[model samples]
Target chain A: MTKPVLHLQPRVKTMISNATLEQASYEIMKKAAIDIPEDYLAGIKSVAAKESEQLSGFVIKTMINNYEAATEDRRPMCADTGLPRYYVKVGDHARFDGGFTGMERAMRSATARATIDVPLRPNRVHPLWRTDNNNNVGINSPEVEWSFEPDADWIDITTVHKGGLFGTDYRMLFPGDGIDGIKRFLLDTLISFGKRGLCCQPAIIGIGLGGSKDTCMQLGKQAACLRVVGNRNPDPKIAELEVELKDVANGIGMGPMGFVGSSMAVDLHIEVGHTHTGGMPISVHTFCLSSRRATARIHADDTIEYRTDPMWFTPYYRRETVIWENT
Target chain B: MLNKVNLDLPASPDDIAKLAIGSIVFLNGIVYTAREGVYNKVLVDGRELPDDLTSRSNVNFHCSPAASKNENGEFHIGGVTATASFRFSKYLAQWLDLTNTKIVIGKGGMPVNDYKNILAPRGAVYLTTVGYGTGALLGRGVQSVDAVHWLNELGIAQALWIFKVKNFGPFLVDSDLQGNSLFAQQGELINQNVEGLYDGLKEPALHRYGETGNRKDELM
Candidate 1:
């Protein structure tokens, strides 16, 4: 596990080149568009093996073939390349040549280049006028979200091309509504979008419980896109809930394309934040069958290493107790 | 076993009638891509059909291809996937009657009633792209770009694409001539057992006015 930009001095740090960052960004975009992640591929295959319905089975088998075809031909796996976006983690100790604005420009430039090079669908458009630059780059399009990590010297750029429409919802429930309320809303979302395969199950279902409405949505989206199958919440009780919810979802008697079977979800993940004492706000996000995501680790040495896992959630990131040493 | 069949493009009336609700199909010959953008243009805007659209293809796909043009103006097609079909239901009747389209291919099929009322009545059947994610496999079948319209007006996602394809599908016949639909049938079967999922699950303290508790009825 070679960390890009590892072992930097506390006082003297190397500044990463903006061009190198853009280059890494572009490569990740192509990799995410063309290659199905190994974690997701394995997860879907397991679900497909358990799928009993003939039609549902056929859909999974064909998707496997589609993955192969996409790789062989070096094309976007799905026609709807989805809304390309970035989740970047910056190291507190690391330095970069470009200012924040310059970094943003590099990302935008990379998005346009990948849109043409990978021939991405250019799906982003203005909400009012329906205007397109034909490069998938527009105002507030290809959103870049930033987070920070302490005591690290590498910038991890993760590109997630999540489908824009369907399979996501938010609800506000009272504390009295409890886990049962969570389960009910989860069922509503899954069954609602799962019908006719609109959500494109078997998917990675991410649930965000407890947070401000916007934060709730963000946590759920990150949970679905960043985490891999078989990963669980750090808290044992929450992990248990994840497992129970996964069972409840699959027991809905639906599979791929909403056919009768046992494979509605490959896995379900949950992320939480402290919320209003009176409200339990929750959001659900489904990362579809294609599950397009790839990451690049840009080290201080200007070397870029690509990987499938995002590793966005760290112990410090999810610090249950504040990490401050002094009271 | 699931029934499988191959149908030539500009399908004849006989071929349309023989398709069963759940049978898988592979298409040969020409197919044209149209979605809300093209639908609004032709049906709502009262624009004339592009020259020879029907003569070139009878199958109308609700799709946006992963396509772009290089400096040389040669189009590069990466993949093609269908969008959900239900959103386009309002225009299907006018579009079908106007063009004599015999096949409508998209992601999820239109609402069950739309199939019986609008499509079957107009001699049109809906074919759903299998998995909805098989863009690459389908892209492989596109042999040539015969023509494209509205590239300047409607962006690539909404442009009218005339693709000459071969063995170009593994689509499931969603609606037959009898107005039967594969999705509705499958939904009913799943709904029968899914009702148990809500057992002992409590509803939220407050409900949205538009919310429906009937799980059997889908949100679509």
Candidate 2:
């Protein structure tokens, strides 16, 4: 049997100019600073529906009002506009007019510009001298991380305004300890620090399992920034664990702002990878209810599309009812 | 029941003591903003209090707001960032004693014992506003912003701003001068809940993950 003859379409080289990249970066940063993503807003609304506690409901309502006011006025949602972080996915086939360094330079300039235009709070302080750079431009001012995608013709950039609130914690568990150990570690951390303004309730919890410490941490951060609320891991066991952890966290009743409420964490996102047989590293990164993130794409033609959802994680179907165990 | 009281600056000990945990206040008059650096400079570094901030009924906001200048070069405040209060609780206890500050406003509740020992004796209350509701707090609550100090030195994070506010809260009185803390009580209840959940899960956790001989240590 002869293989069918296949005709390959000619590849079109996309020319992404530094100016276009800079402008796109600026637009994304501005939008991220001012706007909370639609999915997050929807999650807030959903949780608001379930909030029976008077103060929690009032806080949630106020959050919705604040979101509206911030968007309308083009003001930042939170005063802590936070440290700017950019995650860039470069297509293997895409070519930059000025190369990668040029792209980095463009991102830096765009960040500086947005710092002034969006008037983002200058949260970056000199690490050693403790001096303030009014423009928020210093060594590695806007942290940029890159990844390459094969056979892709467009670049996707997601900007995150990492606030000062959410604190990250990591632990190395013995492989023999198993998944139950991971659960215990997570619960212990959340119970102790979650209410201490670290893991803000009604938060988006991201858990990274089974990697080196750095890899786990990076994956956890990505999970927190890019995962959509109400979405879970694609793996069945991990997805079930996500639901169970969500139930357990919310059951703590730390509530909104750590007051009293039924709604604590709105969603849990877990990313797992194989690790050395001896070590199972776990890292937890939380995004507060305000979860500030935005994404933009630059096509081969240089046409830009701004997106509310970054669309990083796999989506899972929601369970209609969560079974509660009698304690 | 939550009370809607309008508190004036240099609030008297009686006023601070009268407030109860869970009471809502609509603060009027002037409040000064302060964060870590300001606390360090004043309390730790032994800097003198500026005349502008010397009111006996002082309300210090634990905020580092995002403020910007308009085309006219007039500064307009964006809103306040709610930081963790416990980070500054010990310093605040000292500052309150030194300054006789009446009210402290921030996000998250401070240590329970601090409210009982330091704050109650000094005649102060800790109020909590909705976290991340900066725009709502600025647009609807704060009346005006003025006297931005340390804008160039500390950046917006530590720059002290004098905010004139009217009905500026729906602030929950998390800590009152009567040695009561709403959040502290909530924390205790949460602790109980966590303990209960952990206790229930212990047997299952041990059964699933525990070694045959050393079950208890792994659970711990």
Candidate 3:
């Protein structure tokens, strides 16, 4: 859980190398694919403990075994391997040997290398042509999104391998529609994709409220992939709604693989942004059974620390208000 | 405890009859991978399949293994999981008729209509992979990559792969001889309480075009 400092002296001589970044990137890719995060593992265990349906319970127990098998075998938990993508956070004071573009090249090559070494299913392709590059790298295939952190001197990179289909949607609602509208949309997305376990239930459901449509989609996806189970929004009301939504999702009378049970959600996360007063655009994203994600923080000294928890939504990243709105 | 059975590949009519919805299944023998890519090639393009294909194996897997060729030209398969079966429903009937495929394995089960109308009469059954994330376990069951086809054209994800497998399951029987489907039965039970989840949620002020009250086309 690294936090941003208010002010810090910038260091001069130490710079992280591009090779180190690539190595870390490739390592996290493997880790994300094979090892289910500790928090999510605990969350699923709790969900399994309370799952009452006989068959659904069997599925959960099988999943527990699957996770162990994945680690011991050192193989990916799921063959889909998903749409591998990245979130790169650059510390303002950080210095690296290669420029940003060079880092990008390193990341891209790392993606290609990991795809073959780990043999990740090359899931990406041309939108219409369907041409497979076979390396999981093509024209903007493994999307790399960048952000910056203030008063920090380390670059943090998180890779998320999320499924491309199902358990996601976007809708435009009027402010007049209110929270009830949100509830309806959530139920609609869940029930629709939760059929035959298409969305792969007991998933971590993420909701994005406010912002424009595109931002809403990004926020919701980030809320789903970037946050760990049981982590809540900073806003108290949003946090409470998170709890309520999880209960609602779990009470849907469905469990893993869409079987009849009460374990539909591992947890629910909500992210919001100020938007046009006239409309509330919303997006829902469900990070499924194999919620694969991993993070690495590269210090100025080039020492890297890898972990499952992303710690992506730092307080500074979610700060509200502007001291000066106009010049 | 759910009933579990080990099925032999190139199964006979009697073997398919023993399957029932909700039972777990494992397979021993040969299975071949074929989805839209292989389907369009053989069924649509009117191409000929291997002469002894049906005689060799009757199980058509809607799968694409995470596999790669090592420097030695041998394949290293990491994980194996099925793609959604419902999407390939259009090809199954023809595929089954052409190749005598008796067992279909994939991620989600095929449509309920598919079971009753297409599969039952042909003595075919559907088995859905459990968790849909049991790739590693399934990978362990793969004895060897016996052969592969269309690797260059369809690519690995859509290539036709022939695998020798043992203890290859943990798949739930989604459809049986009588056309009864485990998913459909469970779905019906789930739908009974589905409305309760939206008991008090009101409609939004704005509704998108083509937004139906129900997803009638949803697979069972």
Q: Return whichever of 1 and 3 wins on DockQ.
A: 1
- Pairs of residues at least 3 apart in sequence or in different chains that clash in candidate 1: A4-A299, A5-A299, A5-A300
Indicate the DockQ of the complex predicted as candidate 3. 0.77
Query: Where does candidate 1 stray beyond 4 Å?
Result: A1-13, A325-327, B212-220
lDDT of 1 by residue, A1-327 (tens): 986887866773377999999999999999999999999999999998888789889999999999999999999899999999999998887678887778889999999999999989999999999999999999887899998888888999999998879999998888999999999999999999999999999999999998899999999999999999999998999999999999988989998888888887899999999999999999999999899999999998778999999999987677677654311
lDDT of 2 by residue, B1-220 (tens): 3356777766777777788777767777888888888888777788777775765338888887776677897776665556767788768777877776778888787788888888777777888876544544554466777577766766777877788777676677888767788877777766767766665333322332323566555453
Predictions in order: lDDT = 0.91, 0.75, 0.89
- What DockQ number belongs to candidate 2? 0.34
In lDDT terms, how accurate is model 1?
0.91
Q: List model 1 lDDT by residue over B45-162, tens digit each.
A: 9999998998878999999999999899989999899999899888888899999999999998989899889988888899999888998999999998999999999999999999
Candidate 3 residue pairs in clash (backbone atoms < 3 Å): none
Q: After superposition, how far is residue B147 of candidate 1 from its true place, in Å?
A: 0.6
Ranking by DockQ: 1, 3, 2
* Over 4 Å off, model 3: A1-13, A324-327, B210-220
In order, what fnat does every candidate score?
0.88, 0.45, 0.78
Task: Give the CA lDDT, 0 to 100, for residue A17 in model 1.
Answer: 92
Q: Report the TM-score measured on chain A for model 1.
A: 0.94
